[model samples]
Target: MKLKSFLLICFSMFFVVSTVQAATTISISVNGTTVKTDVAPFIENGTTYVPLRSVEQIEGLSIKSWNNKTKTLIISDPSKSMTFRVNNQSQSDSPLIKNNRVMVPIRFIARNFSSDVAWNAYTKTVHVAKINDKEKANLKSEDITESRIAAINIPIISTLKELTAGESSAGYFQLMFPEGESKNFFTIQNGIINHYQVKENAAWLTWSGIIGGNKNTNTFWVTNTDISSEVGQRPTSKDRLFFYNISEHSGQSQHGYISTNGEKTILGSKDMNSLNDLYPIPEEELKH
Candidate 1:
C-alpha cells in the first residue's frame, strides 16, 4: 500500500494549490452596497483579472473592439475616455484574454468613470469608486496647465528641486526618455509653454513648454542630471524640485526659470532615481 499512500499525498498538494488561486475576488459595489462572489477572477503573473462584459454592465460603460488582431475596450463617456491592455497593466494598443476573461489596467476604468481606483496587494482586490457630476465639472474647469500633471504617471522615487522667482517666471523642465531614438522638443514664448503630450500604447505624459515675459528663445533650456546632484540643485537661486508619482510615464523636473526680461540664463542637470523603481511599459504599444 506504499504506492497508494504516495498518490494520495500528491493529489492533496494539487488540491491545495488550486484552492489558493481560486480564493482571489473582486469586491463590486452597487448603490453603496457591496457584492462578493465565490467565483475567483483569473490571475496571471500577479495581475488580478476580471470579465470585461461583467465590468461594463455593472459600471455602465460600453466596451468595443475595432481591430480584429486587437481586442479594444472603449469607454464612450464624454467626460473621460481611454483604452487599456486586456492582459497586462502596461501600455497596450490591444487587450488580451486570460483564461477566457478580458484583463485590463485598472487606471483606464478609473479615468473614464472619474473614479479613484487602487489595487490591494494583500487581498488582490480591484477597488473602484465613482465620482459625482459636480466633481467632474470642477476638474474640467480647472486650468489645464495647472493640473496637467494629475493623470500622467510620475515615478514616486524621483527627487524634488527648489527654484527662484526668476526661474518660476520661465517654465523650464527636462524629461528623461526611455533609451530610444525618440526625441522630445518644446518652445517657451511670452510666458506660455507649448509642447506635445508624449503618449505610448498604454500611457502618456505631459511635456508642454512655457513662455516667459520677454518671448526670447534663449530663455528656455533642458538637461539631464544625476541623482547625487539633486539636493545641490534645489537650493540654487533659480532652481526648483518636485517628486513625480509612480504611475507617471515620464519623471519630474523643475521649470519656470526666467530672467527679468524673460530670458533663460541657466540650464542645469535634474533627475533622480530610487533603489527599487517601477516603470510601466505598455504592452499594446507594440502592435502599433
Candidate 2:
C-alpha cells in the first residue's frame, strides 16, 4: 500500500508540471516593434493567442467600441473593421479573458486586418507586419473594393446604394427599422438582405430601399419607407421622399419626414413634438 501511494503522488505531480509547461509564454512583435502586455501570451492547440489590449499597440489599429453587457469588441484599422465576441461559444475560437485581460487568436486578427504573420518555433515568437505594396497589388479585386467601401461612413439604417449598386462585390451592412410593435433587423451582404424581426421572433425576406447621399451635401433622400413584407420584391413607390439634413456648424445629423408636396416635419420641431432622432443600436444587442 505504501509503494502504491508513492507512485500515485509522483504521477499527479508529473501531470501538473506537464500541463503548466504546455502553455508556454511567447513573445509578440508588430511592425518590427516589440509589444509588451500585462498578461503574457500563450500557445494552445498549435495556435498562439495574445491579449486584446496588446493588439491596440499596433500602429493604425485601435479599439472602436466595446459593449460591456455583451462583451463584444470592435476593432478598426484604416481599411478594415473586425468584430469579436468574448466567450462566444458560437465561434470556434472566441476571445477569452485571462487574468482579467481579454485574449484573442493572433492569426485570426492578422488575416482579418490584411497583415502578414510568421511564427518562430525555435524562439517561441510571433511576428506580424503590414503587407507591402506588392502584396497589396496581388490581393483580389474584391479586397480592393472592400478597402474602399470601408473608408465610407454609412449611417445606421442606410445602405450604400449609389456606391455599391450593380457591383457584384458587396460588404456587410446592418439596418434597423421599426415595425408595428417590434424592430426589424437586416444584414445586407453580397446584394442580398436577410431580415430578422424581433417581435414575431421570425426571419424572412423583405423589400428594402435605397438610403444614400453625397458626402459633400448635408441632405440625403430615403425612398420607400415601408420595409415590412413577406415576399421579396422591388418597391413600386419612388415618390415617398424622406429627407435628412446634417448641419455642418452644429455637427448634428437630424432626421425628418418630408412629404413629396414639400411639407417638412423635423424631429424636435414645434410642429412634430413626438418625432425623435433614431440612435444606433450596438451590434451585440442587435444580434441578441
Off by over 4 Å in 1: 1-26, 29-32, 35-39, 57-60, 64-69, 84-94, 121-123, 134-288
The residue-level lDDT of candidate 1 at 70 comes to 65
- Candidate with top lDDT is 2
lDDT of 1 at 241: 17
Per-residue lDDT for 144 in model 2? 25
Model 2 Cα lDDT, one tens digit per residue, 31-133: 5445777778887666678988777765567889888888899999988788889973323367876667778888788767766566655345576756344
Task: Give one digit per residue, the lDDT tens place, for model 1 in 1-288.
Answer: 122222233223223334433675554432222334434454455544455554563244566543435655565454455665354443433346655556554444544465544443433345454434443342243433212222122111101121111233222223222111122222222232323222211111122233334544332333222111111121122322111221112333322234423343333322323212212222112111
lDDT of 1: 0.33
Identify the leading candidate in terms of TM-score.
2
